[model samples]
Every structure is written in C-alpha cells, then in structure tokens.
Target: AVESEAEKRDRATREIGKRVMEGWRILDKKCDDCEVPMLTQGKDDDKGECVLCGKGQKKVLTEEERDRAVSEIGRRMLDGWKLEDEDCCEVCDLRMCSKGDKKECVACGPVLPPVNVNLELPPNFDFSDPKALEALLLQVQKKTSTANQVPPTPALSEQKEVDKVNISAPNTPNRYGSNSNNYPNTPSSMQMQYPNTPSAVPVTNEEMSMIGAEQKIREGWTMMSRAYCDCGGPMMRAPNSREAMCVNVHCVNSCY
Candidate 1:
C-alpha cells in the first residue's frame, strides 16, 4: 500500500510538472509572437507591428496602458513566481522606464525627499494693528525726504554773490576803474599805501580839489540850516525877524 501511494504521488508530481511546463511554453510562445517590443510593454509600446516580423498596423501605447502593463507584470512576478516583496512593483522600486529592455520598469511619479517644510516665524512680527505699518511708512517718507534734499551748488552760490556785488556797486562811470578821465590827466607821482608799512599817499591835485569842494559843501549846508525857517520848507528867513515866513505868500495867507 505504501509503494502504491508513492508511485501515485510521483506520477501526480510529473503530471503537474508537465502541465506547468506546457503552460510556460504557451506563455513563452505568446511572448515570442507578441507584436510589442520587449521593454516596450511600458517604455515604447508602438504596437500592431510584430516585433519579430515587423508586420501589422502600428499602435502606440498610452501612458495609462503602459503603467497598467508594468503593474500587471510586476504583480505576476511577485505572486506567481514568488519574487521578493521589494520587487513587487518594478516602477515603484526602480523609478525609471527604458526602451527595448525587458528589465525596464514603468515610470513612477516623482518622489520628493523628506524635508523641513514648516516655515520659521519672523522676528518681532505684529500684524494686528496699523501702528507698525504707519511707523514703517513714516520711516520711508523720512528716508525719501532726506534723499531728495539737494545741497546748494557752488556755482549757484557764486552767482548769488556776484549779483549782490553788482547791485551794491555805484552806477558811476569810474566805479569799476574803467574810465581814466575820472582821475588826473597826468598820472600822479604817488605811491600805494600798505597796511602797517611806510608808504607815500597817492593824492593828486585833482583829488585834493575834490576833497576841498566836498568840505565847503558841508560848511554851506551847516550855515543854510541855521539861517533857514523852522517850517522845514526850503524858505529863507529874513535877517531882522524872529518869526519865520514862507517865500510863498499865498501859502502863509492860507495857513493864517
């Protein structure tokens, strides 16, 4: 009874092996006859033309189709062939897709590395009121005003000084030493006088005469004021009368 059971088990095992081999053959044949390129299941997927014979209508695989195929292949390899858990999804594991290579996986979406995404708080932040904003605006205005303030240019200052000098100078012919007629016809035999130094005075006869005339004019003004009337009008007082009268008799009559 033991031998018979052993024999039955052996036969069953062989049959199973044969069936598995046949199944594998069918799968291999299908793969060989497949019009799709090798790694093209996920990568290129231009189809309808036999990969080996180059026959049939061409059709390109969509991204979704490629992803599904890759996932399906990975699932089959993982479950049916008993692959490692890490190898379950080639797309997720390798993160790449390539053309014409059976090992090429589908593209998985880009995976970002773990990072510190939280933002840091700003220093001395206050957003509840307008005081801070107003202060900031004031500071900006001050800076702007300071920047806009332009110092008086040297040229402008010099021009103003020139204007003052021109206005203050007398409008006489020889005011700026241009006309020689204002001085004596003959040059005076005089020397320049320097401060704290012994020097000859350059007074000519013409200048002396002018000085004398100016003194006489002053004396005449003094005498005229004493002999004049008290009414402040330009009227001469009589030599004998203490009371003053205007030269215009009509003015005196009108006043009286």
Candidate 2:
C-alpha cells in the first residue's frame, strides 16, 4: 500500500527526529578544535587541530592539570547544556569531577576504539522501514588506524589560484552577504509566482494565474470568491466573529 500524504508527513517527521539524534550523537564525541567527530579515534582529550578549518582549538591539560577541565565541564553543565555520562572522559571512565580507578585507563591507553557509525540518507527514501535505518547506522570501528594516509597535494597552479582568490577577494558576497562588493542588484520588477496558486487551479479550473506577469494587467483575469483585505494582504483571523482582519501588523487598517 502507498503511504498517504498525512502518513508520509508523520513518517518524515519521525525520520527527521532520527537523523537529528544521529547528528546529536555525532557531536557527543566531537573534538573542540577540529570540530571533527573523532568517530574511531583511539584516545580522547581534545587532541590535535586539522590546522586548516580548525577553530577554537582548546588547550589540552595534562592528567595532573585536569582540575580546570573538570571546572569547565561543570560550568557547561550548569549553563543548561546537558553533559551526559558518555560526555565524561571515555579513557578515564570517570565523571568530570570524579577521581576514581581509571577503568578504561587513560594512563595505560584506550582499550576500545571510538564507535564510528555513518549513514547515507538520500533525498527521498522509504522512511517507513525502521530496521533499514538501524542497519544503515550500524557501523563498527576498524582496529587499524588510517591516519598515516597523507592529504592529497594540489597542483602548484591550483594552490596559487586558491591563495589568490583567498587573498584578493576574501570578502566575496557569498561569504559575507550583501555587505560585499560582489552582491548583484535586486531587480525592481519581478512576477510573484506562488506554488499553491497552480495547486488550487486544477483540471476544468476557471481560474488562471497571473504568475510571471511582466506588465500591469487591466482585465481578462477572473477573481476567485476568496476575499483578501484592502491592505493588499490576505484576510486572517479576527478578534470578533463580525470582523475581518489583515494579518499584517503594520497595516493602517488592520481590523474591519
């Protein structure tokens, strides 16, 4: 059986929630500096920076200098941000403040590698299958580390071009929005085409949309029975049963 529109919507919402939780779990073991989710990294303690896109690289404190780290974690927890048990030190196997037997033993080294689970979500899929989603997410960390693999070296010309763009036009409009010189001027006249207008006008429909209308129209357009306020905005809910309202708060005559 095909999923109804309402069923699809509900399933979509649940799928979104599942994906969000996936992302949230990813962040649960993220490196502060690199913003990299150390999916299968052996040790954890806000390690090295990627040095490229890495921002806010937190300083690593020695095992003896962990008092400040505990304080910082405590402060974050107090600020309404939830610090789960898993948020605590994975290697030490201790709470931010707790000084116990290091079961995982940071001093000894990581006994278990970080769980590295990844899922590939398409634009559209049969979200009705929970088992498939679970299977997609069920991934395990490889025992061997691939960190030894070197980053690909770009061609000198390509590198120079990239550096030139970065140095010369660092303030591109796409990067800094309308404040940049690269911003294109917005056209004064543009047709207002709405999606619902076509959806509302079905087979054997008398209404024709003035969508993409280049010039000012005089006639030949049939107005629907749907009433819009004189404010040129759609009529909305009114305080009284007798009154019609213009939803725009800035309107001079909001209620009629």
Best candidate according to TM-score: 2
Model 2 lDDT on a 0 to 1 scale: 0.31
Estimate every model's Cα lDDT from 0 to 1.
Answer: 0.28, 0.31
Structure candidate 1, residue pairs in collision: none
**Candidate 2: worst 10 consecutive residues by lDDT?**
207-216
TM-scores of all predicted structures: 0.13, 0.17
In model 1, the runs with Cα more than 4 Å from the true position are: 1-137, 149-151, 154-172, 176-256
Which lDDT tens digits does candidate 2 get at residues 127-171?
456665444434211212232233432312122222111111232
User: lDDT tens string, model 1, 1-256?
Assistant: 4456456445533432332222111111122453222221221222222333334333344554543433333332322222122343323333232223222233332222212112222456342234653454344434434443444223211222221111111221221234323324212221111123222332222222222222222223111232222322222233444543332111222111
